[model samples]
Target chain A: MQLNESDLSWRSLPGTLPVRHAVVSREQLLLLCRDVAGRGARLVSLWGEDRRAAGVGYVLVVVLDLTSRLLLTESISRSPNPGFPDLSQLFPSAGRMQRATHDLLGFNFLGADARPWLRHSAWAKDAYPLRHDFVAAAVSAPPLPTEIYPFVRVEGDGAHEIAVGPVHAGTIEPGHFRFSVVGEKVLRLEQQLGYTHKGIEKRFEGLSVQQGSKLAARVSGDSAVAYAWAYAMAVESLTDTQVPARALALRALLLERERLANHLGDLGGIGNDAGLSFGLAQFSRLKEDLLRVNATVWGARYLFDEILPGGVATDLAPTALPILLDSLAAMAAEVAVLQDIYDNHAGLQDRFHGAGVLSAKLARQLGVVGLAARASGQAQDWRAALEIPPYDGFAIGSVLAEGGDVAARVAVRFDEIAESLQVCRGLLTDLPSGEISVAVGKTRADELAVGGIEGWRGPILVGLRVAADGRIARCHPHDPSWLNWPALEHAIIDNIVPDFPLINKSFNLSYSGQDL
Target chain B: MWKILKQIVRTGLVTEPAPNAEPRLLEHALHADIHRLFGRALCIRQVDAGSCNGCELEIHALSNAYYNLEGLGIKFVASPRHADALLVTGPVSKHMADALRRTYEATPEPKLVIAVGDCAACGGVFGEDSYAGLGRIANVIPVDVTVPGCPPTPTALLQGILAALQSPTSRVDKRSASTYQKTEDRG
Candidate 1:
C-alpha cells in the first residue's frame, strides 16, 4: 500500500504475520490514517501507552489491517501537554478508541468526541489509571457523582426513549442501550459499554509471560482458545521461539472447535430469539454433545490453557480420534437437517429475511471485520486468507453471504460451521507427530510483538510488550467487538425495538471483550 | 416440518440421570425438598456482575435438553422481580458493582445469591478489588453459595443451586447467617 506522502522509514516487526511499523508527527499521523482509509485499510485497534519513563511521553498506537499485512502507526507526544490529532474523521471506529485512550492516559484528541466512553464515573476526575504515575488505594475514591451521559436527544411528534440496562434481562454481560423510538419502530440506538472493565490492562503489568497467557484467555472467556493462541503467538514471536508442527496443528484444531461451539450455540440462540424455541432445543443439544467430547478429549469443556507459549499443553491421543470424528460426523448431518428446516420454515424465514440489514457499504465504512462483515459481503477471513500456520496447508474456501441481515448472518454461521468441521476432521486424520511443547527462551527487554488471530467473532489482536525486568510491560488484547459494536448501533436504525434482541443475537458481539 | 419433528424425536431426551451435577448428592432428597420449599419451581435471575462470560456459557447449558433445568423446576427469568435465586457471575467490576447491588435489592426475599464462577467466589485470575472493580460477588452482596471453577460446569452449577436450596444457612442473609457458621472449637 502506497502512502500519500513519500520518504518515510518503515521497520518490519518480527512475527509470523507481516507487520511494519513507523513513527510519525501529529500532522503525519492524520495524513497516514487518511491515506490508509483511502486505500481500503481499516483501523483494527487504537490504544495508548504511558512511556514517560523512557524519555518518551504518552504514545498513541493504532494497528491498521492492510488485509495482507498490518501497519502500525505510532505518534509520540513529547510536549508538556501530550496529545495527537484525531483519526476518527478517516475511520468511524477510531472514535470510541480515541475516547477510551483519553480516559485512560489523559490524552486530548482535538477533533474527537470528548465524552467519557469507558470511564463510567468509576474514578475521580484527575485519575488516569493507565498513566505511569497513577496508583490506586485499597479502596478507590468513591466515583464522582455519576457523571451525566448526554445521549443525543431526538425530539419529534411521537419520539420516546426506551432505556435498557447495564444489567440486561438475559444472562449476558452488562452494557446500556438507549433506543429512541416511536412505539416499537426504533429511530436510533446509542450504547454505553465498559461495565465489565475489571482493570485487565493494568493487571497485565508485572505478570510473567506465562501468567499473562492465563489472564489473556479470560479476557473474553467465550474465545478462550483463540485468545490463548494469540497470546502464545505473540510471546513466541517476541522470544523467537519456534513452536512445533504437532502443537501448531493441535492449536488449529482447538481454535476450530471453539469456532464450532460458538457458532452452534449462537445459531441456536438466534433461532430461539426469533421465537423458535425448537431451534434452541435441538442446536444446544448438539453443542452440549460437542462440549462433552471436548471435555473427554481435551480435559476441559472450554479449551483455555491448551495453547502455551512455545507450543500446546495438550496432545491428541489415537484412541480419542474416533470419538472426535464420530461426534463431528453426527453434528454435520444434524446441522444439515436443521439448515433445511430453517430454510423451508415460513415463519422463521420471514423473521430472518431482510431483518436488521446492514448495507455492505456501511459495514465497510464502519470497518466491520469477521463474520458480520462476511455476511455483509466483505470477504476477509484472516486465518484462511492469510494462511495462518496449519490453515495455510489446508483446503479452505471462502464463505460469504449477501443481504447483511439476520438470515445472511445465519447462512454465514452455517457455512462456517461446515467448513470448520472439515478443517477439524482433516487435522485429526492427518495429525502430525512431534513434541507438543518446548521452553520459550529469555525475552529481550523493551521488545513488542503483535498476534492477530481470526477469532470466531472477528480478528482478535494481541499487542504485547516485554518489560525491562522480563515481565509484561504493557498488554492490549483487543477484541473485534470494538469495531463491530458501533456497527450494531447503526444496524438497529429502523428495526422494531422488539426485534432488537433477535437482531442482536445474530451478531452476538462480546460485551466483556470490548469492555476490557 | 417433518425434518424438525424427526430431529426432535431422534434427539429424544438426552438429559442425564438424576444427581447429574454432583453424583454424590442425593437427588431424591434435594428434589423433594425443592418441591416442598418452592412448590416444584425455582425462578432464577442471572447477572453478569463482571467476569469473563465463561460462567454464562455453562449457565446457558443448564437450559439444554441434556441438563433440562426446566424439567427440574428451575427456570431463568427475564427480571429480578420474578427471581427466587440470583446467579451472579464474575468478579464485580466497578461499573457493574452498583447495578449488581440494585439487582440483588430487586429480587424477592427468601432469595438465594449463588456466585457462579471462581471470579465471583473469590476474584479469579483477574484478581481482587481495585479502581476498576470490587472483586467477588460477596464484596457487593451476601453470597449464599460459591460455585467455584474457572467457569463451573453445568453439573456443578446445578449442584450449587440445589445446595443453596437445601442449606439452611442459605435461607438467611450471609451477614445474619452467623449462627450457622460452625465454631472451630467444636463446642
Candidate 2:
C-alpha cells in the first residue's frame, strides 16, 4: 500500500494491522483522499478517535479502491493540533461523516462543513462520550435540554412545519424528521436521530474479541448478519482464520436471503405509501412467507447471530433441504407475479417513476453506496469488489440503474432479488459438507485484520485491533448507512413532500446502524 | 379503471397473505398437519419496544419471501387486541416501555409472548450498555416464548413463533430457542 507523504503504512503492526497507520498531518489528508478517490478507492468511513489507548486524540479513515481491492487507512493526532484536511468539499457525504466523528471523537475536521449528524442531544455540546477520560455511568452535571433544532425553512404562505416522531405511528425505529412543506408538497426535510444511541462503540473497550461480535450484530438489528459478518471478517482476518467453503456458501445464502427479504418488504411498504394497497398487501404477505421459510430453513427469520467468527453456527438440517428448495420455487412464482403487478400498475408507476431522483453526479459526489448508489449508477458492490469466499468464486453481477428514482431503486431491488435467488439455488446445489465452525483459537496479541462482507446493504467493513491480552483495542463495523443517509436529503430535492415516505422507504437506511 | 379492476380480478390480485397467513394450499395442508402435531394456528401481533430494529427485522422476515411463515396459518395482526400472540423485538427502551405495556394490556388473555433475539430475550447488547432506555422486553412485558438469536434467523424465528403458537401453553422452551443465542450477550 502506498502511504501518503504525511501518512505512514504498515503491513504487520504492533497492535492489529486493521488499525493500520496514523496519517500525522492535517493539510494533505484531503489531497491524499482526492488522489485515492480518483483512483477508484471507495471511502469506507471517517470517524474520530479519542480513546485513552491512543494517548492523544486522532481522526481515522478507511478507504477501499474497488479496482485493486485494497483498503487505504489514515489517522492524524489531536495533540499535534487536532485538525485534518476536509474531504467534504470534494465528497459532500464526507461532511456528515466527518461531523459525526468530530462530535463523538472530539477531533475537529478543519474547514469541513459540520452538520449535526447523530449528534442529537445524546450529550451537551461539550460532552464527548468516547473520550478516554469519559465515564460510562457517571452522574455528571444535569444536561440542559436542547432547543428545537432550527430546521431549514421553505418560503411560502401556508408553508408550515410539522415535526414527526422520535416515535412514529408505525413500529419502526426512532428518528425525528422536521418537514417544511406547503400543504402536501414538502419543501425541506431535516432528520434527527440518535434516539437509540446504545453507546456500543464506547462499550467495546476492554471486551474480548469473542465478545465484540455480538455487539456488532446489534449495531443495526435488521442488518445483523451484515454487521456480524463484517465484524467476524475483521477478527478472522486479524487472526488469519480461513472459514470453510460450506460456511462461505451458507453466508452467501443467508446474506442473499437478507437482501431479498428487506427488498420485498420495502417494495411492499413503498407501494403501500403510494396507496397501492394491492401491492402493499401482496408484497408484505410475500415478505412474511419468505421470512417464514428462512426461519424453517435457517432457523431464524432474520438470520441474526447465525454468522460466527470462524463460520456459521449451525448447518442446514437434512429435512430442511427439500423444504428450502420448495420455498425458493414458490417465492420465484410470487416474485414473478409481483413484478408483473409492479410493471403494469399505472398508479404505482406514476408515483415511483420520477420520485426521489438522485442524479448520477449527485450520487457520486455524495459517495452514496449500496442499492441507492446502484440506482444512481455508482455500480459498486463489495461482493464483487473484495474477493471473499463464495462471492469470489462466482462472478458477482453489480446491478446498475440510471434512473436513481424510487422506481429505479425498486427495480434494482427486484433485479438483485432475482440474482440472490439464483445464488441461493446455487448454494443449495453446491452445498458443501463440513463442520460449520472451526475454533478461532488464541489470537496473537497485537494482531490486526480487516474483513469486509457484502451485506444486504452493501459492503460492511470490520476493522479490528487486538490487544496483547486478546481484548479488543478498537473495533469499527462501518455500516453503509453513514454514506447513504445524507444522500436521502439530496435525493428529496425538488420533489414534493408527500412523496417523502416513498423516497425514505425506498432508501430504508439504519439510523441505529450509523449512530453506534 | 373498471377494466383494470376486471383485469386485477381476472389475475386474482396476485399477492401474498398477511404475515403468518399461509399460502392457500399450505394453509390447507398445514392446518391438519399442525392441528395433529401442535394444536392450531395462532394469530400473532408484533410490537417494537424500542429495539435496535434487528429483532423486528427477523420478526418481519419470519413472514417474507424465503421463509413464508404464512404456510402455517400463523399471522401477524395490525392490532394486539385481535391477536393471541405477541412477538416483541428490541430491548424495551424506557421511551417504549409504556407503549409496550399498553400494547400487551391491549391484547386479550391467552396471549403468548415470543421475545425474539438476544435484545428482546434479555436486552442483548443494549441492555446494560446504553443509557437511552430500559432493559429486557420481559422486564416490561411478560414473555412466553424466548427465541434468542442476536437477531434469530427467519427460520429460527418461525420455529420459535410456530412453537409458541403451537403448544400455546408450552413452557418457554429456550433450549430449541437458545440455539441461536450462543453469541456473546454484551447485555
Candidate 3:
C-alpha cells in the first residue's frame, strides 16, 4: 500500500499476470522494498540489464509478488561498479540475485554477501556477458584459472565440509553442494550452482522475437510449456496481439498438462530418493504412459516445441480427447492407490515427516514461491491468485500445507496432481471453438513489457525490452528457483547429511533456471 | 504388504522389447551376445553435460517398469571408475567442459560413450564451438554412438546403449562418420 498509484507513477505492464512497473530512485527503491516486506509481499526475482546501449544506463530490476499482483521497481545506475542499496536484509534471496546480477552485468548491490554466482572458470573477472558491448566470440576464449569459492566455514569442533558435485553420480543437472557436517549431522548446506550456465541469457540477445519462443522452451527442459507461454504472453502483449479465447484455453490445457507431467515425475523422484523403488517404478510407468499419450496426440513426447509464440503450435485432434480422458482416469486411479501405499507405508512416512522442516515463518521471510511456498503454508498459487485469462474462466483454488516438511511437500504434490488432472479435464470438456492463433503484428520498439505464467515449479516472470530495430534488447527470464534455492540452504540446517537428497527433491528447485 | 503385492501383480511386466539390434540374424542374438562375449553387466555412468533435463527425463524413464533397464543386466552406476559406458547429455557447457573431460579420463580403458539428444550430437540450435564449448559431446571426448532428438526417447536411448555395446572398438570409426570428421578419438 506504500506504493500507491497516487504516490508513485506505476505504469501497468500488459500481460496475463497483474504487474505494475515504475522506475524509482535509489533511496525510494530501498524504502519501497521495506514497505512491501511489511505488507507480506514476497520477492519473486531480481535481475540487472545493461541499457547503456539505449543510453539509459545500468538498470537493476526487482520483481515483488504482492498478494494479488506483481510490483516491479527499477533503479538505474550511471557509472561503473554501480551500487544500489541491497534489499537482501528484507528478502534473503535478493543477496544471491544481486550477486548473479553483478556476475552477468556489472551492477553491484551494496550487500554483505557479495560472492560471485554463475561464474565458474568460464570467464575472467572483468567479463560481463549480459552487457550490451560483450563480444560473442570472446565467450570461447581460453578458460580462466580456477578461483576457490569462499564458502562460509562452520568454525566448531568436529565440523567438516563435504563437497558434492557440479557433476553428480546420477543423471541429474550439475550443481556443487557443500555440506558443513559433524559426523552424519549437517550443520549447514551451501550450494554453488552455474555448471548449467551455457550462456542462455546471452544467447537470447539479437534473436528475432519470433525465434525467442524456441529458446525460451529450452530454458529449463521440464518447464518448456511454462516458459514458452510466459514468453509468448509478453510478446503478444508487446505487439498488442489478442489471442482467441480458444487459444487461451488451449494454452491453459497445455500448461496444466505440463504441470501434471512434472508433478508425476517429481513425486516419483521424491519416493525414489526416500528409498521407495516401488514408487519410482510405478509413478515413472504412469509418467511414461502420460508421455506416450502426448506422443500419439501431440507429435513430441516431451512436448518441447508444442507451445509457440502466438499460440499453441498444434490444435487438439478429435482422437486426442477420448484417449486423454481415459489416460487421466486410469492415472488417477493408479495414483490414488499409490498415495494410499505411501500414506500407510511406515518407513516412507518416517523419512518424510520431520526432515528439512522449513517453518512457515522462515518460508515467508525468505520469499519462497511455487509449490515449495505452498507446502509451507504460503497460500499463494499464481493461477488462483491472479486468475489470468483462461484460468479466470474457472475457479482455481490454492492447495496449501502447514507442515513445511518433506511430507508436507509430498502431500501438496499429490493434491496438485489431482487438481491439475481436474483442471485439464474441465478445459478439455469445455472446449472453445475458434482460431488457435492470430498473426502478431510488427514488433514495437523501445517497449518494456513483463509476462508471467505459473509453471510447475513456480510463476516464471520474463522482463522483455525490444531494441530500436525490434530485436530483443534485454530479456531476463526470472525463475522461481531464484527465491527457493536459498530457502533450500536454510531448510537443510541441522538435518542429517543423508536426508539431503530427499529434502532437496521436496523443493526440487531448477539449477538451469536459477543459473540462467 | 498384500496391497503392495497386489498392485505389483496387477501391473505385471510392462517392459517393451528392446529397440532394433541389427539385421534378421542379429535380432534375437543381441541380448545373448552381450552375455556370450562381454559376460558381464553393461554398467553406465550418466553425465548431464549441461542438459535442460529433458534428455535426463527419458534416461530416468529407462528405469521405469515400462523400460526396466535393470532387468536387462544394465545398471546406471554412481562412479565413473566402475562404469563400462558413459551416457552424456546436453551441449557441453564451458563451465562443465573440464568436469566432462575429467569424467572421461576417470573411466577405465575400453569405455564407450553414447551422446544422447541433438545438443550432444551436433550442438542442436546452440551452434557448434560457440558459447557452450564445441556443442557436441564427441568434441570433448570419444563418442561411440549418437542418438538424435530434442531429447531422444527412452527406447532410442536403450538402442544407443546397445549400439555402443555392439561396436567392435570402444571408440567410433571416424572414417564412417559422414557429417563431421576428426572426433577427438575417432579411429
Candidate 4:
C-alpha cells in the first residue's frame, strides 16, 4: 500500500476483491501515476465513464496491476471542462487508452496524443457515443466518407508506405495496418483498428448483472470462457455471492481447454505462414478433434454461453468425462509428434528462427503479456501469479523463452498447450462434487469491483460498477491485446514485408479484442 | 521429407469422407438449377462486417482436413472480383457498411450472399438500433440465405452456402432494389 501515505486522501472501496480507490484532482493524478510506476505497478487499463446522470460529472478510472493486488484510482472532471493531465508520458501504454477515452467519452488527456483511436468518422465530431446525453438512436445516416488519417510520415530514401486491410485475404477480422518500409525492411508499423467497434461498452449500460455475462463473453470470441468467468467474478464479488467449488473447477477446465484450442490453432497458423502446409492440415485436424470433444462435452464447438454468473450454465456429463480424458490424451500425443516435426523441419526452422524479434527490453517497456510476453522471457502468467482458486491447486508451470522470435512464440504456445492439457486432466481426475451454480444476490449500488483472469492470450481485466437500481452502470473489459499490440509494431521493425504475416501470426493479437 | 512421409503413412488419410448431400426439400428442388449454373466448383469471398471473430473461426474450420471444403470444390478466393458468392458474418457496423456494399458490388453478376451467424442474420445480441451496428446483413446488403447461431457451426455454414447457391434467384425478386435504396439513403 505505497499509495496509502499520499496526501491524495485515498478511500477504500467496498467490494469482495482487494482494491483501493481514490478521487484526486487532475494535477494529483499525474503525481500518483508517476509514484505508482516508480513502485513497479503497471497501468492495466484507463477508461472514462460519464457520470453526469448521477450528478458527478465525468470520472476517469486508472487500474494498476501490482502483481499481488490491484489499485484503482479515479478522478472526476466536471462537464464544463473534462480534461486530465496525461499519464502517458510516464507509462507509454497509457497513450492509446487515453486517446480512446478522448474519442468515446470526449475526455481530453492533455499532453497525450489527441488523435482519435476509436472514432473512425462514424459520427460527427462533437457526438461522443459513451456520454449519457449522447443519443444512440440519432445516428441513422449512412457512414460518411472517412477522412484520410494523417499517418506519421517516414520520409527517407526508399521508405514508401504500404497500407493493408480493413478486409484481409484470409478469414480474419478487419484492421488497417500502415507499414513504412525501406525496400524490403520495415521502418515503422502503424495499426489503425476499431473497424469492429460495435459500441459494446455502451451496450452494457442498464443490463442486469446476469445478462451482462453474455455481452462480456462476446467481447472477444476466442477468450469467451475467460471473459465470462471474469465478468462472473466481478458480479459475484460485487454481490458477495460465493461460487461453488465445483463451478470454480469447471471454469478452470473450460479456461484451459480454451487455451489449448487457441494454441493448437496458432501453432498450425504459424507453421502455415512459414510455408509448411502439412502443419496446417495436421494441427487443424487436431484442433477440430478437440472442438468435437468440446461439442460432445460442453455442447458447443466454441463453448459459447457456457459460463454464467454465480456458476456454470451446464455441468460436465458423467458419460462424457472419460471420453474427454481420452481425447486429451490423444491430442497431447499428437501435439508432441507435431512439435518434433516443427523443430526439425528445415524450411520452417529457417523462416521461424530469427524473425520478428521483440527484445526483453522492448517487451517490458510495452508491458506485453500472454504468450507474446512469455516468448520474450517475461513470466507474467496470472495462473501462477494471481493463484485464484483452481490454478492454485494445479501448480501451473510458467513457460518462458528468451529469443522473442517467431520460433520462441511457437515454442511458448506448444509449452502452454501441453501445460493446459495436464491441468485439464488434473481437474477431471479430482472432479469436485457440489452444486454447479448458486443464486447471486443483488449488487450494491456504486460498488466497483475488478476481475482479472489469465486467458490464453494473457490477463483480461474486467472493471464493473453497479448502478443505483442494481443494474450495470458501466463495464470495461480490457483485453491484453492493448499492451501486446504495440509490441507487434516494434517486433515488425527491421523485418521484411513477407515476414509480417509470420510475425503477426506468431503474436496473433486479436483485432476484435483491441477494437472493442 | 521422409519423416513427414512416415508420419503421413502412419496417419493414413485421416480425412473423413464428404457427407451425403441430403439437401433440405427446398434446397433439393433448386439444387438441379444450381448444379446446371455453377457446375462443380464454387469460389467464395468472405466479408467480416463486425463480428466477434467467432463465426470466422468456424468458417476457417471448414477448410480443415475433416471438413475438407476444398475437397468439395469449394475454395475461398482472395479477391471478391473472382468470387461467385459472398459469405458474410457479424452485424454490419456503421464503419464497415460502405466496405460491405463495395465488396458486394465488386462480385460478378448472379452472385449469392449468405449471412452466417445470429449477428449477421439479425444483429444477434447487439441489435439493430445500436450506435455502431445495423443489426442484420440484409439491412445493409441483399442476403439470399441466412444461417443463424451465436456462431453457426462449420456444417451449418457449409449448408447455408450450398443453399444460397442452389436458390440463386429465389431472394432477388423483392429485396434487390431496396438494398440499393438503403445504401443510397444511408450514403
* Local accuracy by lDDT, each model: 0.87, 0.70, 0.83, 0.84
Pairwise TM-score winner, candidates 2 and 3: 3
Candidate 1 lDDT (Cα, 0 to 1): 0.87
lDDT of 3 at B27: 38
Give the range of the ten consecutive residues with the poorest summed lDDT in model 2 chain B.
B171-180
| Model 4 stretches with alpha carbons more than 4 Å out | A1-17, B17-35, B168-187
Task: Put down candidate 4 lDDT per residue, B22-84, tens digits, no spaces.
Answer: 434434444455455566467899999999988988998999988778766679999899887
Give Cα distance to truth, residue A55, candidate 4, Å.
Answer: 2.3
Report lDDT (Cα) of residue A66, candidate 4.
73
After superposition, which runs of candidate 1 have C-alpha atoms over 4 Å from their true positions?
A1-6, B20-28, B172-187
Residue A272 in candidate 2 has what lDDT? 82
Q: Write the per-residue lDDT of candidate 2 for residues A1-516, one digit (tens) a residue.
A: 344523544443221122334343554565566666776555777666554464545546545444435544556565733666777776666777777777666667777766666555446556666666655553222223554665677777897888876655455676778877777776777776665665677668678877887788777767778888878877776666878888888888888888888888888888888888667657777777776687677765667678989988878989987998888898888788778878888998999999999999888777788888899988787777655668766766668899999999989989998888888898998898988888787776643456667677766776676777888876766788888887887777678877887899999988677767
* lDDT winner: 1
The digit string of per-residue lDDT tens for model 4 on A152-228 reads: 99997777999998888889888899999989899999999889888889889989887899999998998999999
What tens-digit string does per-residue lDDT give for candidate 3 at A1-516?
255433678988765667888989878888788887887888888888888767888888878888788888888888877888888899888888888887888777764577888887777668788886777767567567668999988978988999999888777899999999999999888899988887777777888888788888888888988888888888987888888888898888888888888888888899989998888888888888989998998887887776666777899888889998999999999999999999999989999999999999999888888998899998887787877888887766568899999999999999999888998889899999988988888777877787888899888888788877878877888788988998899999989988999999999888888776
Which ten contiguous residues of candidate 2 chain A have the minimum total lDDT?
A12-21
Instruction: lDDT winner between 2 and 3, please give it.
Output: 3
Model 2 sits at an interface RMSD, in angstroms, of: 4.7
Alpha-carbon deviation at B169 in model 2, angstroms: 17
TM-score of chain B of each: 0.84, 0.68, 0.82, 0.80
Instruction: Order candidates by DockQ, high to low.
Output: 1, 4, 3, 2
Highest TM-score: give the candidate number: 1
Give the DockQ-based CAPRI class for model 2: incorrect
lDDT score at residue A396, model 3, on the 0-100 scale: 68
